[model samples]
Target: MTDKTTSPPPSEEPAGELLLTSPPTFLGSVEGATVEAIAALAREGSVPTILQVPTKGLGPDLPDNVPILWDRHAQKPISLLEEVRAAKPPLERVGTAVVTTLASFIELTNRHKDDGSAIFAKTAWPEPKLTAVIDYHMPGETKTARRGKHRIAYPFPLTDEFKVWVAGHGKTFKQADFAEFMEEHAAELAAPDQYEINTFEPMFKERFGTPAEILDLSRHLEVNVGAKMKSAVRNASGERQMVFETEHTGANGQPIDIPGIFIVSVAPFLAGDAEPEVVRIPARLRYRAAGGEVVWFYQLYRWEFFLRERVQDDLARAAKETSLPAFEGAPEMAA
Candidate 1:
């Protein structure tokens, strides 16, 4: 009997109205330019949103208004050993040891050049001065113990050869003084094997003032030995559930599934040693269609490193090599 004004039921509300009433809109994008646009919108007091961009080149220019949502991706290519080996230059069947030794020397010298300060900081060793001396003995025999002793007796006088050595170590030493100092040390510097003597020249100059500084420097300038990190991956759990099994189409318009495994191993720095520790670290991977022309949506995956104790066993062998007095100052933890 009441005048019932017919009203629409709550369920009859429009979807857009329901959406608007439910919550303020939050949007997300991964493209850099798109993120810039969303940030502009946010600055105007619009609804807050999130955008995720590839970690590749996102610089400091990111806006303060927008929040970043990082989604981890599982690292692909489960095995890194083959991949790393394949990446290296082909080794000759003969003279493998010599080649490896030279390669190690070159690598060490280049590393010293690039981050000499960092290396010195870690070791508390003085900066090495590169010098070159004429080698009276032939190349192959120069490394032998007897030859090494003989060379030490007539130590090559430091000369322009030192400058050349520094330059060969890295191109960054253009301004470094090579000849002036050699003339100063000409009286005291004794010849050692060309290779070994040259390697230690920089250390000698750094620790000692002149020829008199060699023995003291030799005591402290131990070769810093450590493993190089090859690759790494972390465990997959918790938040990692997000990147689980999103499909990815391949280059030839085919679908390829990628699994997550972050593997990392140390590169051997010393000779006659087994591999160093293989530790897994956290990592993310991205996948996209491989076609040259058409673009596709990229998929992200997250995974964690699965550490194996066996890797440590392999690293133990290298650890043993460093036990001798010769390697006392090598950058390594006590066994």
Candidate 2:
């Protein structure tokens, strides 16, 4: 005869070992039937573990020792019971706060105001300044308080916008990548000419930043100039502009105006003066014929001078934009 014994159901068994401590801990669920070794790790008192949930189910049995933080969208519809906490009590706090988003920050500000006042009140707080980590690191309240009553400081992480732009000052890009670099800093190319920057360049696939007819004509000339380019730009439509003909018309009873070899405009990624003071750069277009192919390239006259002028103009503009005191020297890390 076999020994008759009753055992509990599988569901009734504890999912895992739960440590009832200051912050209740759950060291992951148990594995399948295998004798495994456990290594020693810091206990609840030394290093308490935090649990994050996507749902707002603070359901039936919650341990008082554990606190769960779930980022609930502040504007989402909530239950009547959720409203109870708003009027519960008047608590005071003077602790430092760093909100994750501007919306959340605004929500918090609105929540703390008097009964019927709007979240975006006229007396609402000003935007807190984003100070560098070094400032927060130094000793004192002036740095902590920052510029306003509400403040948020960030650790100078590499991905921060300011950090990224500052880092770009030291970066180098390949010729192939130069176009992308120009695109990214396109705004820097627009300080002149009110707000519109008109340019005619032959490299791009389509007409841009210039009058329809002008750009179309420029691209037409560019693609038709060489046999290789003609092959590259030709389409199935077989539409070609027969601009040049095999004939002799030195002057058709009138003086022909020859387009200047130089292209006069602001250099890319450079600050240029408002015209008619804009610099005129001569771009000598010369084609290289080798290996039965033609490659086109241009040499800009006075390019170095243009760069030097732009840098000086940029520095001068920087000085004019702000009233802050500045000195000419390399920037140093604030100790």
Candidate 3:
């Protein structure tokens, strides 16, 4: 009858197939990991790439096989993006290159006991020398909007002391804000006197103190003039909150029994023979409890340094000599 062999309707392409067309080669297992991976890719070649990573708070660490973590938990993505974007053009212009990895950064930060906080107490360490000045702009929030101010400025001051430490040991300027904050409030932090008793002592006494045993308990606990003090108060609802800080070092040599908080700050400055100024880096390390160990994790933040031409030249020279084969030539080509 009818020679109607109608062709079947054309099938739509599958979404997975469409994605495979590009085939994302440069991928990470976390969100901000893109920055470091992209930077690495740029150093290798100006190849376009895409990265994928686990969403925030999904895990404590980067997923297995992921090349980089980007330390998004320590710093926000927008900020990191801004830094990379701002640094890109200058680095390219000067023929310089850089590669950052989460594993390298973590290793750098973990090299010292107490994360180099001990250096501050050494007194022999030279005072921080001004290098480049880094300017930080706080993110806009509802509270800032209400105040008609959207940003707060931060300054990072770097010193030769820190540079030496970084050169010999791969230390990072994480928690710089805590260090800066503490320096700002140094005058306010004073050790308690012998006559003064901390707020916790009353609780200790009420739970375990007799009038005759009070002095013995205090002595047994090693309470003395230089001891730090702290207090916690319970509201009518029986909820407890810490009121203030004093001074005390935990088993890990962290400021556990201290009364006040320590905050770090950062700024940019010039260093080495490089005439052009660079970003100043500062950091602070504080002790916190984690996994039954008194470990220290830093809340690293940085200030912006407008990437300059000369600085880029210096970086390029350095990159040419380092592991960045793309800057010089591919390994096979060089061979």
The number of the candidate with the highest TM-score is 2
Alpha-carbon TM-score of each model against the true structure: 0.16, 0.26, 0.16
CA lDDT of each candidate?
Answer: 0.26, 0.32, 0.29
lDDT of 1 at 130: 15
RMSD in order of candidates: 39.7, 26.4, 34.0
lDDT of model 2, residue 22: 94
How far residue 88's Cα lies from its native spot in candidate 2, in Å, is: 30
Pairs of colliding residues, candidate 2: none
lDDT of 1 by residue, 206-264 (tens): 21122333322212111111221111111221111111122333323334333221111
Model 3 C-alpha RMSD vs. true structure (Å) is: 34.0
Model 2 whole-model lDDT (C-alpha atoms): 0.32
By lDDT, who's the top model here?
A: 2
Judged by lDDT relative to the true structure, which candidate is superior, 1 or 3? 3
How should the candidates be ordered by TM-score, best one leading? 2, 3, 1
